[model samples]
Target: MALTKKGEFWYGTTSGDTQAELRSYSVANEHEASRFAASKCDCGCRTFALQSDEDAGVAIRTCTDCGQEHLMGDSADHLDDAAPETHECVCENEVFELMSGVSVTPGTHDVRWYYIGCRCVECNLVAVFADWPCDAGDAAAFLAKV
Candidate 1:
Protein backbone atom coordinates (compact mmCIF):
# COMPACT_ATOMS: atom_id res chain seq x y z
CA MET A 1 0.00 0.00 0.00
CA ALA A 2 1.00 3.60 -0.50
CA LEU A 3 1.90 5.97 2.30
CA THR A 4 -0.96 8.00 3.63
CA LYS A 5 -1.36 10.95 5.96
CA LYS A 6 -2.09 9.60 9.40
CA GLY A 7 -1.81 12.76 11.49
CA GLU A 8 -1.06 16.44 11.50
CA PHE A 9 1.12 18.57 13.80
CA TRP A 10 2.42 22.10 13.99
CA TYR A 11 6.06 22.25 12.85
CA GLY A 12 6.96 25.72 14.19
CA THR A 13 7.00 27.49 10.91
CA THR A 14 5.17 30.41 9.35
CA SER A 15 5.19 28.86 5.92
CA GLY A 16 2.39 26.61 4.63
CA ASP A 17 0.11 27.04 7.64
CA THR A 18 2.92 26.20 10.06
CA GLN A 19 2.03 22.54 9.98
CA ALA A 20 3.78 19.37 8.94
CA GLU A 21 2.27 16.26 7.51
CA LEU A 22 2.56 12.89 9.23
CA ARG A 23 2.39 10.00 6.84
CA SER A 24 2.58 6.30 7.41
CA TYR A 25 2.79 3.57 4.85
CA SER A 26 1.44 0.98 7.25
CA VAL A 27 -0.33 2.58 10.20
CA ALA A 28 -3.88 3.69 9.69
CA ASN A 29 -4.47 6.76 11.85
CA GLU A 30 -3.09 9.27 14.33
CA HIS A 31 -3.57 7.05 17.35
CA GLU A 32 -1.67 4.21 15.72
CA ALA A 33 0.99 6.66 14.67
CA SER A 34 1.41 7.69 18.27
CA ARG A 35 1.84 4.11 19.29
CA PHE A 36 4.42 3.54 16.57
CA ALA A 37 6.32 6.65 17.60
CA ALA A 38 7.24 5.30 21.01
CA SER A 39 6.10 3.20 23.89
CA LYS A 40 5.29 4.43 27.39
CA CYS A 41 8.22 5.64 29.41
CA ASP A 42 9.19 3.83 32.59
CA CYS A 43 7.82 6.82 34.46
CA GLY A 44 4.37 5.99 33.07
CA CYS A 45 4.41 8.90 30.70
CA ARG A 46 3.45 8.13 27.14
CA THR A 47 4.68 11.45 25.82
CA PHE A 48 8.27 12.13 24.75
CA ALA A 49 10.69 14.38 22.97
CA LEU A 50 12.24 13.06 19.76
CA GLN A 51 15.49 13.70 17.89
CA SER A 52 17.11 12.00 14.96
CA ASP A 53 20.25 12.17 12.84
CA GLU A 54 19.96 10.95 9.28
CA ASP A 55 23.70 10.68 8.86
CA ALA A 56 23.76 8.08 11.57
CA GLY A 57 20.22 6.78 11.04
CA VAL A 58 19.63 7.16 14.76
CA ALA A 59 16.43 8.24 16.43
CA ILE A 60 16.28 9.05 20.12
CA ARG A 61 13.19 9.55 22.21
CA THR A 62 13.37 11.25 25.59
CA CYS A 63 10.59 10.93 28.09
CA THR A 64 8.86 14.21 28.63
CA ASP A 65 8.07 13.76 32.28
CA CYS A 66 11.31 12.27 33.59
CA GLY A 67 13.90 13.17 30.97
CA GLN A 68 14.98 9.60 30.33
CA GLU A 69 16.25 9.04 26.82
CA HIS A 70 15.80 5.96 24.68
CA LEU A 71 17.31 4.90 21.38
CA MET A 72 14.50 3.85 19.06
CA GLY A 73 13.55 2.64 15.57
CA ASP A 74 15.27 0.37 13.07
CA SER A 75 18.27 2.66 12.89
CA ALA A 76 18.70 2.70 16.65
CA ASP A 77 21.62 0.32 16.41
CA HIS A 78 23.42 2.79 14.21
CA LEU A 79 22.94 5.47 16.82
CA ASP A 80 24.18 3.16 19.53
CA ASP A 81 27.26 2.46 17.49
CA ALA A 82 28.02 6.12 16.80
CA ALA A 83 27.49 7.33 20.36
CA PRO A 84 26.96 10.93 19.29
CA GLU A 85 25.65 13.60 21.59
CA THR A 86 21.92 13.90 22.09
CA HIS A 87 19.74 16.96 21.80
CA GLU A 88 17.80 19.04 24.30
CA CYS A 89 15.38 21.84 23.70
CA VAL A 90 16.52 25.33 24.53
CA CYS A 91 13.80 25.61 27.14
CA GLU A 92 15.39 22.68 28.94
CA ASN A 93 12.31 20.62 28.34
CA GLU A 94 12.24 17.12 26.94
CA VAL A 95 8.73 16.78 25.61
CA PHE A 96 7.74 16.63 21.97
CA GLU A 97 5.25 15.28 19.46
CA LEU A 98 6.43 13.60 16.29
CA MET A 99 5.58 13.98 12.58
CA SER A 100 6.80 12.20 9.47
CA GLY A 101 6.85 12.65 5.71
CA VAL A 102 7.98 10.67 2.72
CA SER A 103 8.72 10.82 -0.96
CA VAL A 104 8.11 7.87 -3.23
CA THR A 105 8.53 6.62 -6.74
CA PRO A 106 5.63 7.58 -8.97
CA GLY A 107 4.26 4.14 -9.77
CA THR A 108 6.20 1.59 -7.76
CA HIS A 109 5.60 3.35 -4.41
CA ASP A 110 9.20 2.75 -3.40
CA VAL A 111 10.23 5.23 -0.78
CA ARG A 112 12.83 7.65 -2.08
CA TRP A 113 13.11 9.85 0.96
CA TYR A 114 11.93 9.87 4.54
CA TYR A 115 11.72 12.69 7.04
CA ILE A 116 11.05 12.75 10.76
CA GLY A 117 10.11 15.89 12.64
CA CYS A 118 9.43 16.88 16.22
CA ARG A 119 7.46 19.64 17.84
CA CYS A 120 8.70 20.64 21.27
CA VAL A 121 5.81 20.46 23.71
CA GLU A 122 7.23 23.17 25.95
CA CYS A 123 8.20 25.86 23.46
CA ASN A 124 6.30 24.64 20.36
CA LEU A 125 9.46 24.77 18.31
CA VAL A 126 9.46 22.39 15.37
CA ALA A 127 12.46 20.82 13.73
CA VAL A 128 13.07 18.26 11.04
CA PHE A 129 15.55 16.10 12.81
CA ALA A 130 16.04 13.25 10.35
CA ASP A 131 15.71 12.98 6.61
CA TRP A 132 17.52 10.64 4.29
CA PRO A 133 17.38 8.81 1.03
CA CYS A 134 15.64 5.46 1.00
CA ASP A 135 15.37 2.71 -1.57
CA ALA A 136 13.20 0.17 0.14
CA GLY A 137 11.12 -2.26 -1.88
CA ASP A 138 8.56 -2.51 0.89
CA ALA A 139 7.75 1.06 1.73
CA ALA A 140 5.33 0.15 4.49
CA ALA A 141 7.78 -2.04 6.30
CA PHE A 142 10.55 0.51 5.92
CA LEU A 143 8.36 3.19 7.46
CA ALA A 144 7.23 0.93 10.26
CA LYS A 145 10.79 0.07 11.13
CA VAL A 146 11.72 3.72 11.25
Candidate 2:
Protein backbone atom coordinates (compact mmCIF):
# COMPACT_ATOMS: atom_id res chain seq x y z
CA MET A 1 0.00 0.00 0.00
CA ALA A 2 1.31 3.46 -0.85
CA LEU A 3 0.82 6.30 1.56
CA THR A 4 0.10 9.15 -0.85
CA LYS A 5 -1.77 11.89 0.88
CA LYS A 6 -0.74 14.95 2.85
CA GLY A 7 -2.31 17.39 5.32
CA GLU A 8 -5.28 16.82 7.59
CA PHE A 9 -8.18 14.60 6.53
CA TRP A 10 -11.68 15.03 7.80
CA TYR A 11 -15.22 13.79 7.28
CA GLY A 12 -17.61 16.63 6.88
CA THR A 13 -21.37 16.78 6.55
CA THR A 14 -24.02 19.44 6.14
CA SER A 15 -27.01 17.90 7.86
CA GLY A 16 -25.78 17.34 11.38
CA ASP A 17 -26.93 13.83 10.69
CA THR A 18 -24.77 10.99 11.88
CA GLN A 19 -26.20 8.86 9.12
CA ALA A 20 -24.69 11.16 6.59
CA GLU A 21 -22.02 9.72 4.43
CA LEU A 22 -18.56 10.33 5.91
CA ARG A 23 -16.92 11.98 2.97
CA SER A 24 -13.11 11.86 2.78
CA TYR A 25 -11.91 15.44 3.11
CA SER A 26 -9.23 18.02 3.88
CA VAL A 27 -9.42 21.64 4.88
CA ALA A 28 -9.66 23.68 1.69
CA ASN A 29 -10.27 27.10 3.13
CA GLU A 30 -9.83 29.25 6.19
CA HIS A 31 -13.46 28.93 7.21
CA GLU A 32 -13.32 25.16 7.02
CA ALA A 33 -10.08 25.09 8.98
CA SER A 34 -11.60 27.27 11.68
CA ARG A 35 -14.65 25.06 11.95
CA PHE A 36 -12.43 22.03 12.12
CA ALA A 37 -10.09 23.56 14.68
CA ALA A 38 -13.06 24.43 16.83
CA SER A 39 -14.35 20.89 16.59
CA LYS A 40 -17.68 21.94 15.31
CA CYS A 41 -20.18 19.13 15.73
CA ASP A 42 -23.38 20.58 14.30
CA CYS A 43 -23.93 23.34 11.82
CA GLY A 44 -27.53 24.43 12.05
CA CYS A 45 -28.37 20.78 11.57
CA ARG A 46 -26.62 21.28 8.31
CA THR A 47 -23.03 20.19 8.88
CA PHE A 48 -20.82 18.03 11.10
CA ALA A 49 -17.05 17.72 11.35
CA LEU A 50 -14.79 14.78 12.08
CA GLN A 51 -11.06 14.38 11.55
CA SER A 52 -9.96 11.39 9.50
CA ASP A 53 -6.45 11.49 10.98
CA GLU A 54 -8.04 11.10 14.38
CA ASP A 55 -7.56 7.38 14.02
CA ALA A 56 -3.82 7.66 13.21
CA GLY A 57 -3.50 10.18 16.09
CA VAL A 58 -3.31 13.57 14.33
CA ALA A 59 -6.37 15.59 15.06
CA ILE A 60 -7.28 18.63 17.13
CA ARG A 61 -11.01 18.24 16.79
CA THR A 62 -13.20 16.79 19.48
CA CYS A 63 -16.67 16.48 18.07
CA THR A 64 -18.76 13.54 19.20
CA ASP A 65 -21.09 12.42 16.53
CA CYS A 66 -23.34 9.57 17.59
CA GLY A 67 -21.68 9.36 20.99
CA GLN A 68 -18.21 8.82 19.57
CA GLU A 69 -15.60 11.34 20.72
CA HIS A 70 -13.02 12.09 18.07
CA LEU A 71 -9.66 13.44 19.26
CA MET A 72 -6.18 14.08 17.89
CA GLY A 73 -3.27 11.98 19.08
CA ASP A 74 -0.41 13.81 20.70
CA SER A 75 2.13 11.09 19.95
CA ALA A 76 1.14 11.03 16.32
CA ASP A 77 3.98 11.41 13.83
CA HIS A 78 2.61 13.93 11.37
CA LEU A 79 4.22 12.20 8.42
CA ASP A 80 1.82 13.66 5.95
CA ASP A 81 3.63 16.91 6.44
CA ALA A 82 6.98 15.25 6.89
CA ALA A 83 9.68 15.29 4.26
CA PRO A 84 10.29 12.67 1.57
CA GLU A 85 12.53 10.70 3.95
CA THR A 86 9.41 8.73 4.95
CA HIS A 87 7.12 6.99 2.53
CA GLU A 88 4.29 4.53 2.61
CA CYS A 89 5.21 0.92 1.82
CA VAL A 90 4.35 0.89 -1.86
CA CYS A 91 4.86 -2.80 -2.47
CA GLU A 92 1.81 -4.25 -4.13
CA ASN A 93 1.44 -6.87 -1.38
CA GLU A 94 2.56 -5.12 1.76
CA VAL A 95 0.60 -3.10 4.26
CA PHE A 96 1.86 -0.90 7.08
CA GLU A 97 0.57 0.32 10.39
CA LEU A 98 1.68 3.69 11.71
CA MET A 99 3.71 3.05 14.82
CA SER A 100 3.52 4.91 18.14
CA GLY A 101 5.38 8.08 17.06
CA VAL A 102 7.73 9.58 14.52
CA SER A 103 11.51 9.17 14.45
CA VAL A 104 13.18 12.55 14.33
CA THR A 105 16.79 13.64 14.37
CA PRO A 106 17.95 14.65 17.80
CA GLY A 107 18.19 18.43 18.34
CA THR A 108 17.31 19.05 14.74
CA HIS A 109 14.17 19.85 12.81
CA ASP A 110 14.96 17.15 10.30
CA VAL A 111 12.92 13.99 10.54
CA ARG A 112 15.56 11.29 10.13
CA TRP A 113 13.04 8.48 9.89
CA TYR A 114 9.64 7.19 10.80
CA TYR A 115 8.79 3.70 11.99
CA ILE A 116 5.93 1.76 10.52
CA GLY A 117 5.06 -1.82 11.36
CA CYS A 118 4.77 -3.65 8.06
CA ARG A 119 3.82 -7.14 6.97
CA CYS A 120 3.62 -8.87 3.65
CA VAL A 121 0.09 -10.18 3.37
CA GLU A 122 1.19 -12.58 0.67
CA CYS A 123 4.53 -13.81 2.09
CA ASN A 124 3.45 -13.47 5.72
CA LEU A 125 6.71 -11.87 6.76
CA VAL A 126 7.37 -9.07 9.16
CA ALA A 127 9.09 -6.33 7.17
CA VAL A 128 11.41 -3.72 8.58
CA PHE A 129 10.93 -0.06 7.82
CA ALA A 130 14.20 1.82 7.59
CA ASP A 131 16.53 3.39 5.06
CA TRP A 132 16.60 0.12 3.17
CA PRO A 133 15.14 -0.04 -0.30
CA CYS A 134 11.37 -0.40 -0.37
CA ASP A 135 10.24 -3.76 -1.70
CA ALA A 136 8.27 -6.81 -0.66
CA GLY A 137 10.61 -9.69 -1.53
CA ASP A 138 13.74 -7.67 -0.97
CA ALA A 139 13.06 -7.50 2.75
CA ALA A 140 12.76 -11.25 3.39
CA ALA A 141 16.10 -11.31 5.20
CA PHE A 142 14.61 -9.25 7.99
CA LEU A 143 11.85 -11.81 8.40
CA ALA A 144 13.99 -14.29 10.36
CA LYS A 145 12.73 -12.83 13.63
CA VAL A 146 9.31 -14.21 12.91
Say which candidate scores most in TM-score. Answer: 1
Off by over 4 Å in 2: 1-81, 84-91, 96-114, 130-146
lDDT of 1 by residue, 36-74 (tens): 232456777756766667676667677778888776545
TM-scores, all models, native as reference: 0.55, 0.21
- In model 2, what are the clashing residue pairs, if there are any? 14-46, 15-46, 59-72
Tell me the lDDT of candidate 1: 0.53
Task: Estimate every model's Cα lDDT from 0 to 1.
Answer: 0.53, 0.24
Clash counts per candidate, in order, are: 0, 3
Model 1 ranges off by over 4 Å: 1-46, 65-73, 76-81
* RMSD to native, candidate 1: 8.8
In terms of TM-score, how similar is model 2 to the real structure? 0.21
Of the candidates shown, which would achieve the greatest lDDT relative to the real structure? 1
